[model samples]
Target: MKVKFFFRKKEPQFNSIEELFDAVSRKLSVIISVESITMPYGKISFKNIFKNIKYTRANSGKLNHITGHINYVTLGLKGKTILTIHDVGSTLNGNKIKFFLMKVFWYWIPALSVKKITVISEFSKKELVSIIPFAKDKIKVVYNPVKEELKYQPKEFNASCPKILLIGTKSNKNLENTIESLKEISCELHIIGKLAKEQLLLLEKLEINYFNQFFISYEEIIDAYQNCDLLCFASTYEGFGMPIIEAQAIGRPVITSNMGAMKEVAGESACLVDPNSISSIKEGVEKLIDDAEYRTNIIHLGLKNVERFKIDKITNDYLNIYKEVIEAK
Candidate 1:
């Protein structure tokens, strides 16, 4: 049977979902097509929303897959469809009116329209269920597969003056706290996202040695993972912590939060830290830096842990769901 993967016109830097499904679709034996909907000037106006919805409806295939971030289009879709929700943060973080509207259009309506819903982690499934409890029975948990490009690259551990990689700068990513933790620590911080004015000032005030880059290519991202001594991903919240597995897959040790999906995803292979406490995060990093044997042990365990996120297994997981949804009543 043919399947159509519906996607939004994503920015160059934000193509993880597209890249993920691109890999998944290639491994599937069935015929596949891709459809990307665009909005005028890339802004979400009502006119653009309706136009995109109409476009999506007209192009609906035998089996439809609504990728994350553009769930409202599910309202206009006919036939069997599956919706993948990476997180419910967008709906939960805003003011009351915005939250109400997002709940209606983004979660409630689209959820009712789809035959099956796939969430990236158990934490995400619980979050979605809490918002729309009736939809719980149909929600399935699927972990994000580690990218195939991130091969296990063994590197000599840089014990002296180690280069620590931090992936994001968002508030929930806990970048500010991480920076605070690194104060007086002997390591170079390589951050992957654009910094705000306050963050830059904080770094300067802390007298930390750091390098920052934004909108980098996937190759650069892989290089970042491969080159770093350890990944510091102490996020306050996440649907699924992708970097934890990615670092593990690359044979690098990881330090991440001990709560939410970050803890769930790390699964004993990472150095777990309390995201709220700078001292805890610092101590985690410091242990990895000072103890050679412990760091090596974490890296080896991480390599084994990444097997759970293998692409073939994850691809088969999606294929099974596709078959079930297509064959359902």
Candidate 2:
């Protein structure tokens, strides 16, 4: 059967949603076609809404299944569409206006039209259900799959001055607190995303040794995980922490937030800390550095944790969902 996967237009920066479904498409057994649709420009745009509606209506019967972002949900394909809601982060951040608007467009409207809604983590599913209580019945939890190419590469840890990998530069990533926590700690910070001017200034003022790069390839991301002594992902919030699994698959011990999906994704394998507490972050890092056995144990746990997210298992999960949606039609 042919399935049409509708995706948002690719942005230059990191986007987990696109990365996820791309992997899903590669593994599915059915014929798949991907369509990139433009995102709405403003908070609520009638023009973009009409454009999306027209686009979906035009392609209604051309394929067996339609799937894309929740924001792109249209009323045209009542039972043939599936919507993926990554997170209700905007609602969680206390943006009341955005919350109300999202409740209307992102949840309630899509609930009427889409055949299924998938969330990456149980934490996200719970959060989404709290906002739209009626949606609890329809949502499914599908974990994101680690790329098949990422595998265990045993690399010796640098005891002298370890290299700590940091994946994102967004404010919610809690990079500022992480920097403060590592102020006196001796380690090289290898950051993946571009840093803001204020962040660079703070790093310089704190005298933290760091390297920052942007727009790197997937192979480079794997290299980052393989080379680093540990992965630090103390984000304040997340739908599902992909880096946690990626790092684990490469045999790197992880330090992540003790809240939300980070904690859920890490399971018992990662050193968890309060993202709001600089001292907690510091202490977690210190434990990983000062205690060799504890660190080694966590690394072994991480290797095992990664097995749950194997690409083949996650692919089959999506395949089942697609089959269910198509059979219902």
Candidate 3:
């Protein structure tokens, strides 16, 4: 069967969704012919919408499987198309205008046009179903696959000043609270994304030892995980906490939020903390630092947890979904 995976125009920065699906497509291509369709660079306007519709319609007839972003849902290929919904974050943010637009473009329209929807986590599936109740039966949960390079590599914990890895710098990543929590703690903060000016000022004011970088490659990300003593990913919201699993695959214990998909993805292998509470974040970190045996246990459990996110298993899941969708047609 021929599969066409649609993606938005590639950005210079790292994009988790594109990187993940691209890896899956490469593996799936061994058994089936798979092609990727990327949109032309343009502002989101009527012209772009028309171009997408024409592009989608032009290729709809030749492909056995079609899958892409939920916002790109078009009318012509209902049974053959699958829309991937990362999260219903717009609705959850309490922005009425954004919610209205999301309902029309991301949910209701996609619900009418696509045969099925794939979500990264059960939390995301539930959130999407709550907004578009009719889609409950159509949404399937498929966990994100870890990259092949991120495997268990034993490294001694940095005893002088433990290096704590933080993946993103967005507000939802709860970086402010994390910084506050680490004010009195001794650790080298290795942040992966561009830091806001305010965040930099706060870091300076708090006197937190830190390093920051952005637009890095996959190899550098693996290096970050391999070098860190622990991963701190206490985000307030997430579609799926990919970094938690990535850190686990690299044999690092994780500290993540207790709510939303972070908790769901971390399972029992991570130390859960309240993203809104500085004290909670501090305590969690302290526990990991002070207790060597507990830290060692979680590391072992994390290694085991990463087994479920193997590329082969996730690729086969997508292939099965494609086969089922095609056979049904």
Candidate 4:
């Protein structure tokens, strides 16, 4: 019954997949290996450090160096080893040699040793196959789970500012297009997480108001989603878009880029827009804010959309995968 759970250790906040793992770790016979590098917080940020991307460089080089997995394998005589591969971005689109080398090197090392691999989205599963096709049969698309309370409350809206919530890191997320889109859309753009100084300067030029994204408790997030008109995700690419699902769970209409797994996660529930097109984003925002029929419809659809991605369902999938691996061994 012993099993090992492995994840990137230095992520400042526990990732959603890891949170689910922690919630049931004690009940399930599992050990975890966390990558001790602070890559999540220090390197990938919304903060606009235009030059001297030191943290990103360090992250590129050291993102997947989970130093102790060999030890986990050596010690686990009777346990199944389950690896969660959140995304394959570093390997596929880091768009640099150092990043490519590190990600490519570390990506397959775990699959070779672990008994099973849990991917967050099929988008990531496809990429993992592209990296090392041998692991395709072993990789399972276990969607990331959300807390029950985030969107469990009744509907609430703030007509004051008409907020369009865009949450993501500044560098990779298409903040530039979001800012451009804001010029046409009158609503206040609420961005979550830090942005670089250059991004601040640009937003200032666009005459768009932005608040530094603060960390909110689960209740607060639910409240925010309940209040907003649309949960706008302008991310260029994601392995799996968690915020979109979280927003949908809270019964808010989502206006996210049709890129990556967002469309798959949102299905027909969200209004898909082009992340690169400011005009398209502007149009999507306007539809949500001005058209009541559209907003209410998507909200209902979003609630239904989130049902497919329930945490418990994903967890059960993982449990089955673990059982299969253990039985095969």
Best by lDDT: 1
Order the candidates by TM-score, highest first.
Answer: 1, 3, 2, 4
The C-alpha stretches of model 4 lying farther than 4 A from their native spots are 10-14, 23-79, 91-100, 156-160, 215-220
Off by over 4 Å in 3: 61-70, 76-79, 90-94
lDDT scores in order: 0.86, 0.80, 0.83, 0.63
Q: Decide which is better by lDDT, 1 or 3.
A: 1
Q: How many residue pairs clash in each candidate?
A: 0, 0, 0, 9
Give one digit per residue, the lDDT tens place, for model 1 in 84-183: 9999884577788988988888888887889999999999998999988988888999889988899999988888888999998888989999999999
Best by TM-score: 1
Off by over 4 Å in 1: 29-41
**What TM-score would candidate 2 get against the native?**
0.91
RMSD of each predicted structure? 1.7, 2.5, 1.8, 7.4
In candidate 4, list every pair of residues with a backbone clash.
Answer: 9-35, 46-170, 46-195, 46-196, 47-195, 47-196, 48-195, 48-196, 193-213
Error of 2 at 329 (Å): 6.4
Estimate the TM-score of every prediction: 0.96, 0.91, 0.94, 0.79
Best first by lDDT, ranked: 1, 3, 2, 4
Better of 2 and 4 by TM-score: 2
Better of 2 and 4 by lDDT: 2
Task: Give the clash count for model 1.
Answer: 0
